[model samples]
Target chain A: DQQVKQNSPSLSVQEGRISILNCDYTNSMFDYFLWYKKYPAEGPTFLISISSIKDKNEDGRFTVFLNKSAKHLSLHIVPSQPGDSAVYFCAASAQGTGNQFYFGTGTSLTVIP
Target chain B: EPEVTQTPSHQVTQMGQEVILRCVPISNHLYFYWYRQILGQKVEFLVSFYNNEISEKSEIFDDQFSVERPDGSNFTLKIRSTKLEDSAMYFCASSEKGGRYEKLFFGSGTQLSVL
Candidate 1:
């Protein structure tokens, strides 16, 4: 049923510019959200995450903001670099459960130099 | 840094044949999961295991599928009498303490093709 969705199939941005990726989820049960970055022939690596209780979480150049009332979340990479280009997946999981994360189809990001 | 490892980067099996895929999760992780993606499709969960038993499984994991942690290091998925629809890239993931949901490390994936 695609409980999680990344409507944008791809995005492009110039180096030193801001890049934003968006995601929406239909499942209100989800309380935690995560973002993963992947390159060709490589495993997805953890980027950043936010709990439903908080509105925003940041790590250096990357930031994740969760809007619980909107059932939406976003990942923002400031001053994007060429190395930041990759496919980004947004995943959602419910609270206190071992249930696996439901992943979106993924959005490819291109940071042009 | 610990990472999930999967064997036989690619496998091509005949329809109705048996296939076994293997994975070695990070040593300290307490929970393990399997996910698969057909080309051009989103990743879907197959199963989750903890304490040598299955904690959860998806409907796609049917009678034809089985999972085992035969030893301390290896986690395996066996598909008995496979079919054409079984072709997909399967990923193994592991997490600590079971439920933070902040991060779940994934493997590069093992591509299986049933012809």
Candidate 2:
């Protein structure tokens, strides 16, 4: 089942600009959402997370906005750098659902210098 | 940084053969999980383990699959009979907490190719 979907296969942005990645979910039961970044041959590294109770969460240059009503979430990175270029994945989980995570196909972000 | 480590970065096996993928989770973590991703697909959850027992498993984790924590640190996933469709990258993850909001630390992954 494709509960989580990242419609964008790839995104390119100029360095020092803003990069926005979007994700949509079909499961309203998912209360927790997270973003992960991964490099070639490496594991996915947690970037940020947001709870359904909150609309926005920011950490350093990364910010995650959640709209529970629309079942959509977006991750924004301000002043994007080349290092930020990687595959971005959005994941969601529901409490008491064995804590299992459902992940989207992923978006490849390329920050051009 | 404390991270999960997996052995045998790549494994090539013949169909119907058995393969065991090993992982070493973070020292202080209490929950362990297995996930696999096909070449062009999203990562799929296989199973979750806690307190030395399986807490949950997905449909992909069938009768032929098993997990074990033989030692205090090592977690292993064994596929009784490999199939060509089983080719994918397997990742092991661990979390400090058991809740859904907890953050999970994942290993680099083991690339399994069933020929």
- Best candidate (score: lDDT): 2
CA lDDT for candidate 1: 0.90
What residue pairs are clashing in model 1? none
> Residue B21 lDDT in model 1?
95
In model 2, the runs with Cα more than 4 Å from the true position are none
CA error at residue A101 for candidate 2, angstroms:
0.5
Chain B TM-score in each of the candidates: 0.97, 0.99
RMSD of each: 1.4, 0.9
Model 2 lDDT per residue over B27-76, tens place: 99999999999988999999999999999999999998999999999999
On DockQ, the leading prediction is: 2
* Candidate that scores best on TM-score: 2
lDDT of 1 by residue, B1-115 (tens): 8899998899999999999999999998878889998886778899999999999998899999999999999999999998999999999888876766536888999999999
Worst window of 10 by summed lDDT in candidate 1 chain B: B95-104
TM-score of chain B alone in model 1:
0.97
